[model samples]
Target: MILPETTTVAADEWVSQHRYLRDSGLRFFDLLVAVDLGDQVTEVVTHVMSADATRRAMSRIEVRREERIPSLVEVFPAAAWHEREAHDENGVEFAGNGDLRVLITAADPPPLQRSAALEPRVDKAWPGLYEPGAVSGATRRRRPKPVPGVNEEWINGGRQ
Candidate 1:
């Protein structure tokens, strides 16, 4: 009954961690996408599930400004489309993913990632940072919880 935890992982470790999850009981691939954090960091998120879909965990990889993340398609083929979406929306570059082609019709700025060029990413602030307001309007915070007994080194797709 536990929702997939959002575990922050490094770009290099993404594949390995996901591979480990696949090798383990969580063999079901769920989803993958990214959020433009607007601080030179795009938070890439992916989730996997147990065969029954009851047990799952989310993995978030913080891709720093100008950093290229490795592709997860090698481990989870489903990542292909998700990575394309991230690239089309947020301009994130998944290094090994060959299909980084624009997923949708978009301009140079991309639809979802449009901070004023003159201002720093932090100063410009990502539009829709608050869905409607600071309170009940949106999920303004990360409520990610870790899976029990899953260590950071491997569980949730971090480190090891």
Candidate 2:
């Protein structure tokens, strides 16, 4: 069967929505995570289940890349670790979480971010650097594509 739909909410309403979920019988905190939607937005996902473990629901909230969100540690203390992982992996900042320290990579860029920003490989075609389905596996570079950081214009408007 298809999974139940997840409810999406604004970042500001996340904590309250989660509290509502708990009051509505979804008292089990399954997980809390985040997805990198480029540098502009990050989608945080939350899953909760009924105390009887028979019902469940998922919720999502989007936060601007440079913004902070309140932590749910006060509600579900177990969420501290999951939120930390999201912060470590996707560069999300939970406002009330005292431990936003990088859990995995303390120095490297977020693992979920675009690899192109960190590694320049014009010689080797990456998945999104080219048109979709243009190259299945590995293909020789036929032309010199614009590099993102070499020229400021490339990053601004040169690529287009």
Candidate 3:
């Protein structure tokens, strides 16, 4: 029933406060869910259930880009897989989780940011330094080889 400020709490604080939930008769960590916001933010939802109705409750958290929050796997063993899924799919970092890798194992990148993939990749266009002809203020010269069969005399024939 405690709602922390900013929807995210320090890992240590969270674990300490919820330690009792472990022994509160909740046998299962139901799921770790996430909602994707196009601009690189996701809302995370963690669900837990107790065999007794009075203790059953849900916890919500938010994960943002460039932020690392603690994972609940230590408090709820069942959260291991859920944390992994959140990390893989939504790019949420579960700070304390030892393993951080894609769950699906496909070569494709995460689906969270589809627009980035569709955008053109222009960085590889130039290998190293810019070529003279490729940019302004660049000059180019071409030299033609002499012809073997026709002598200068024949070519200049009548004129000279």
Clashing pairs in 2: none
Best by TM-score: 2
Show where candidate 1 strays beyond 4 Å.
Answer: 114-160
Winner of 2 and 3 under lDDT? 2
lDDT of 2 by residue, 100-136 (tens): 7767786456877543244343333343345454566
- CA lDDT scores, all candidates in order: 0.73, 0.74, 0.59
In angstroms, the error of model 2 at 85 is: 0.4
lDDT of model 3, residue 21: 57
Model 2 root-mean-square deviation: 7.4
Global CA lDDT computed for model 2: 0.74
When sorted by TM-score, best at the front, the candidate numbers are 2, 1, 3
lDDT digits (tens) for residues 32-144 of candidate 3? 78776655667777666676644565566655677777777788867788878877766777878997777984334455543223222322222222343555655524322
TM-score of 2: 0.70
TM-score of each: 0.68, 0.70, 0.57
Q: What is candidate 1's lDDT per residue for 92-129, written digit by digit as tens?
A: 88888998877675666665663423223334433333
Best by lDDT: 2
